[model samples]
Target: MKDSLELRTVTVTRYITPLREGGSLPALAEADDDFKYVLKFRGAGHGVKALIAELLGGLIARELGLKVPELVFAELDEAFGRTEADEEIQDLLQFSKGLNLALHFLSGALTFDPAAETVDDTLASKIVWLDAFITNVDRTFRNTNMLIWHKELWLIDHGAAFYFHHSFSNWEKSAETPFSFIKDHVLLPRASKLYEVDQEFKKILNRDKFVAIVDQIPTEWLEWEGSDFSANEIREVYLNFLLRRLESSTIFINEANKWRDASI
Candidate 1:
């Protein structure tokens, strides 16, 4: 496994197409490394906060033994999308002429269909626990945000996680709060081993690992408009939030158990 602080940097060579599935207009672009990636623009509607959440959520999931696509820092030159026909996309590219987030594109992958597919109790419990841990509200039955690639589950599109950063008031309180949205999770019905996996998963992550992950966030992303905290201060906030959340894991684990039990 690569070091938690290490992420490769790639330059965008071509903008193939736009993924219009969600509010953020992430694109399927080719990089200088000759690999295609789903590029998440920092200039999207959700802005840099979404990118920060994406980095934190994806990396944290990988640390806990889940399969997430390789994340890279994709660079866009100032002249890179100037000729685009779409005014909106052109504006987005112009505004995002710096380091952005992208995930290794999975070719020929299919969206996870809960009705036609099955997930074991262990995997389901782990996934549920992860979503709850990050406070991700987008992994409902309506939009699983998961893919089936090479006959294995792959997680994706975690820009919606860590929403507390959007408005950092009382963030410490938010960290300890149990996620009630676990009830709507697509795999909630199959997550019978929530308590069992909770014990094992807790051992896989710690404050040191979290500090390394949070340190991976670029300093530019932390300098959001209208923020009172400095870049270094914001980094500390992220570290503190993760540590507090981990210490209070049982609060969410119990909440997930409560919902899972009532659903059956």
Candidate 2:
């Protein structure tokens, strides 16, 4: 495993409040490090795949020089959730009593408003490439899933990307699949440099970095489904799919250009 896999671990010290904006019902909790995080519960309806997306997507963003909030392994002790009077929250805590995921919380960060703010073309292109690469359909205009702090944009909540794992029957073919949904991406209009960004990404990102991202995920999450493949095999499948997508990114780049013209 690459040294990048050494994620900081934090124990949930307090469940401050439930963030109901998302269907998964993430929570704002304080950790032992005196820092707060938006906890993505392992036991949520989205299941472990969502947690994997958060970790993997964040790592990818960081690698590409995007400002994603710090990600860490959050340890959740069952006793910690016992005090929550909310039955729904109690269930979430109970199921998430083991290893969960957390996003390093940013206080007083202003949400991104596309209607009011213009994003840098390079930044926008890189983000659009990433979303398309992962088949993330969640970053639409209505729900940007982005924040801005200190004049820089920050990405959050990537659970909706990488949906192929819900069923692994066609995992290999998924790489060649067209990311048609990216036409509706909130930032696509600003990304007129997709091909160039892909060139840079190809030069910088390699298979080892991809392996390290998967290595950061807990074993239990990977072992649950896919009776045929072991945890390590499943990780390889993810890496291969992403690399394949990179090789064929031009298909989506043309798609985005068409969409940009039509959206006008």
Candidate 3:
């Protein structure tokens, strides 16, 4: 794995089309690298916080041996989208004229269907553990946010994770709380090894790894218009939250196990 701080930067050259599947309006664009990417704009509804969650969540999941598309810091030039006819998209491009996030496009990949494909206990457990740890509210049956590329399950669209940052209150308490929403997880029924994987995952992630991931957040993202906290302070909060959350993994592990047992 590459260092957490070493994401490849690509300049978007063309906006091919708008992917209207989600509220964020991520696009299919070609970058200067001559590859297509699903670009997540910083100016979307959730703003840069969503980009932060996407970056952190994808990196953490990759560190855990999960399949995630390559993430890149996609640069949007100020003059790139001036020709867009859509008013909304034009405004979005205008506001997102900086470093955004994008995932390598998996050509011909199909959306994961729980009824069509089977997941083993270990993989499912790890995924459930990850979602609980990040407090990701997506990944329900209604919208799996998972894809099957080359016949392997790949996770995607983690903008919904780390919701505590949206409110920015009582983060310590939030870190320790049991994420009850794990019950709605699409893979929970197969995640019978939550406790087993919890121990394994904890060993793979450490304070240093967490710090490296948190430090990768661009300083501009932390400088929200009206926020009182400095960029460094916000980064520290993210690091502390992950550390505390890791120490308290059993809280969410037990919660996931409880739901898995009841569901089965």
Number of the top candidate by lDDT?
Answer: 3
Superposition error at 115 for model 3 (Å): 0.5
Which residue pairs clash in candidate 3? none
Clashes by residue pair, model 1: none
Tens-digit per-residue lDDT, 150-228, candidate 1: 9999999889899898888888999998989888999999998987888998788888898899999999999978888
Candidate 2, lDDT over the whole model = 0.87
Greater TM-score among 2 and 3 belongs to 3
Tell me the tens digit of each residue's lDDT in model 3 across 1-264.
777557999999999999997789999999999999999999998999999999999999999999999999999999989999999999999999999999999999999999999999899999999999999999999999999999899999999999999989899999998999999999999998888898899889999899888888988889887889999999999999999999999899889889888998
194: Cα error in model 2, Å: 0.9
Indicate the worst ten consecutive residues by lDDT in candidate 3.
1-10
Clash count list over all predictions: 0, 0, 0
lDDT of 3: 0.94
Q: Looking at candidate 1, what is the lDDT of residue 65?
A: 89
